[model samples]
Target: MYYDGIGTEANEKKGFELMLKVAKSSSLGAIHLKHHAQFNIGRAYFEGYGVEQNNKEAERWWIQAADDGSPNASVLAQTMLGMLYSRPDFLNLKQAFFWHSEACGNGSLESQGILGVMYLQGDGIKQSEASAYECLKEAADRGNVYAQGRLVQLFYNKKLFTKASDLARRVVAYTDVEELARDTGCLAAYITKGIAYACFYLSRCLALGNGLRMDKEEAEKYFKRACELDPVVSHDFHLDVAYGIL
Candidate 1:
């Protein structure tokens, strides 16, 4: 009630003090409150809320929360730990990998996607396309759009055209035809590279009937959309269309 003046005058120090007290003395009977308080302690220190910004203290509290062993708090703590470890300022990919692996195993789709991409590039672990594919596939199957986008290229490079086409379709669906047709290049510039890449592959699949029925008209529409959204995408589509590859 003190933190944001909820039902009382705002007092960040009082709120933080109470949180610290609960975090330090809570017993097993208050396991849930204890871990959450620990996480809040980390956030308070990290954000300099009624306390000096201390990265070391913040990290220690987060680790303490993770060790407290609440499944929900553990997943969140692991994710935060992974993000901190992966920060450009720090660059501790090994520590990032460990926490991300734990979070992924705990069913964090975000961790699964990050770990999969890391594995694909050997960013702290040995490069393994197989591991990347498996990890991404799990997250993609759960409707993670980012994982689906990454999988489009991975499956395409591996000649898994069917899988690539499916993922490509999912990724390209982000581009609404009505919006593309109405928006100018300035708006198109906001489209992400991953979406454009997926559109290119999907356009080719539709044009060539790669494991699916041919739809030249739809393929042309996607090709045009892809080109309008990104000239980089146009380069490949133009060459393939000119050479009868489409």
Candidate 2:
């Protein structure tokens, strides 16, 4: 099953055969086998792995898994279906929003983040800054870095500078590696959240000549710390200051 052509495309047929073998011998293993088979097969078909790309097959498998009460599979299926319907070719914004909303309700952080993006951009849903904030915040609170970054963006877009600063500080404070080692689940997420918060605070400090004295040296230090902790932070424009390039 590890050789499925979904993520790596190693040996799909062999993988499926192995999964079937294990599934027949153990009920517990069967549940996981079924879930993986359904999800991976759907992904393979959707992405055209060893077979002609077919959204219909993908949708079918995802639906079956979801109906079987696989939370992860269900959320993914709903999200993908939402994306399919949201395209201009289909233009079913209401349907897209509905599916995404359902996925979010199923406790999918990815869905929450995607829905936040949709709400923020007014795609497949009416533009509601408040709604976007709520969605992103929900994910962020659960330690989703993408959602935390989006929350920062939303705050900045709406000129909620003070709130953004507060959030940024919180991000930096909560994402310490030391604290994370003591915690569990989503280490990468905490790191990302920390970087986002650090960047925001560093930017504000530079802009206002706050306690840090507006020194390029101090700013670079903080930026470097952020980048070292989370590579994604390097994509932010503040990276220049962090990397001492500025």
Candidate 3:
């Protein structure tokens, strides 16, 4: 409540202090909550909620929480570490890969989706289409939008326009495209970007009658939506279409 003012005035410093106290406490009363406290403290440091932003301190606290053996906190902390190491300022691909792999093994849907991308692009490891397919399929089956987008791209590359169109249709079926585009979290941004990719591909399918009937009006609408979601991506997709890259 103090942190975000759920029912009271926000007091980030007090929230951080309480979390730190819980993290430092070794009593049985605190054991069940300590890992979560540690994770929150790391988040506070990372986002400068109540303290100076310090990536090192964030990393340290997250590592402690990740190793604390609380399944939820451990997985969350590991996933956070992966995201942290992926930042341009941090830029530790190997570390990012390791932490994501760790989180994936712990059944983190986000990490599983990211691992698929890494395998597909060879970002921090050897590229393997087979591994990419496996990871993407697993995550997509479990409703990971990021993995679904990449899988749709894979299908498109393999000339499976029908499958791509089907999946892309599902991805963009939601009614909150504008809200998704405006979200600030990394995962939400990725989801919005993925939705844009899906829209671009779906528009192509409509225009070319590859997997659906040719509908110029619908195609234009979706193409415009792709641009609205992510203009940079839309521009790149437009160039690819121009160059017969699809």
Candidate 4:
């Protein structure tokens, strides 16, 4: 109640203290709740809620939680660890892949989507089109926007422009990207970035009439929208074009 003031005052210090107490307690009653407490403590350390921000400390608590927590908490911790390891400062592609794979096997939608990307990109693992297709197909069917967007790219690469355009259009139909991102409980940046990629693909389809009538003006509008969502989309698109991947 104190943490985010959900039902009371927002006292981060008290919240952190309480969480720490629960996490450290060895009582039988606290055992079940300890993992949850540990997860929150990890979040506190990662975000500096009450103590100074410390990625190392965050990693420690998260590892404990993932190893000994409830199924839900363990999956979340695994996903967080995957993201943390992917950070440039602590980049460990192998570890990132391992955690994501673990979380994916445990039914994390976010990890499932990311595994597809890793397979497609040969990131920390050998590229396997079949594996990528299976992961992306399953995740997209489960309403994962990231997987849908990547699938669009996969179709585009295979010259299945019609299918790619259709998928991209479906992705763009999601007007409330923020709400979707929040509801999915995945990293908002990843969700939004995927949407941005869909926008870029849709724009290219429109401009080139790849699977539909060519409309330069319509393409321009989508192009602008893609950039608005993520300015980096345009840069990435250009690179893809140079590499003939788009």
Q: Identify the leading candidate in terms of lDDT.
A: 4
TM-score of each: 0.63, 0.59, 0.87, 0.93
Q: Is candidate 2 or candidate 4 better by TM-score?
A: 4
Alpha-carbon shift of residue 103 in model 2 (angstroms): 1.2
Model 1 clashing residue pairs (backbone): none
Q: Which residue pairs overlap in candidate 4's backbone? A: none
Q: Which residue runs does candidate 4 get wrong by more than 4 Å? A: 68-73, 242-245
Ranking by TM-score: 4, 3, 1, 2
Least well predicted 10-residue stretch by lDDT in candidate 3: 177-186
Compose the digit string of candidate 3's lDDT tens values, residues 1-246: 677777989999998998999999989999888888888999999999999999999999999988843456668788899888889988888888888898888778888988888899998889999999999999888877767877888888888999999999998885564464344223676777778878888898899998789998999999999899889989999999889887
Measured by TM-score, how close is model 2 to the native structure? 0.59
Q: Once model 4 is optimally superposed onto the true structure by TM-score, how far is the C-alpha of residue 246 displaced, in angstroms?
A: 3.3
Candidate 3 ranges with C-alpha deviation above 4 Å:
68-73, 177-186
lDDT of 4 by residue, 181-233 (tens): 77776677777777887888888899999998898998898888888888886
> Largest TM-score belongs to which candidate?
4
User: Which regions of candidate 1 fall more than 4 Å away from where they truly are?
Assistant: 1-18, 27-29, 44-54, 68-73, 159-162, 174-246
What Cα-based lDDT does every candidate model obtain? 0.75, 0.64, 0.85, 0.87
Output the worst ten-in-a-row residue range by lDDT, candidate 4: 68-77
In model 2, how many backbone clashes occur? 1
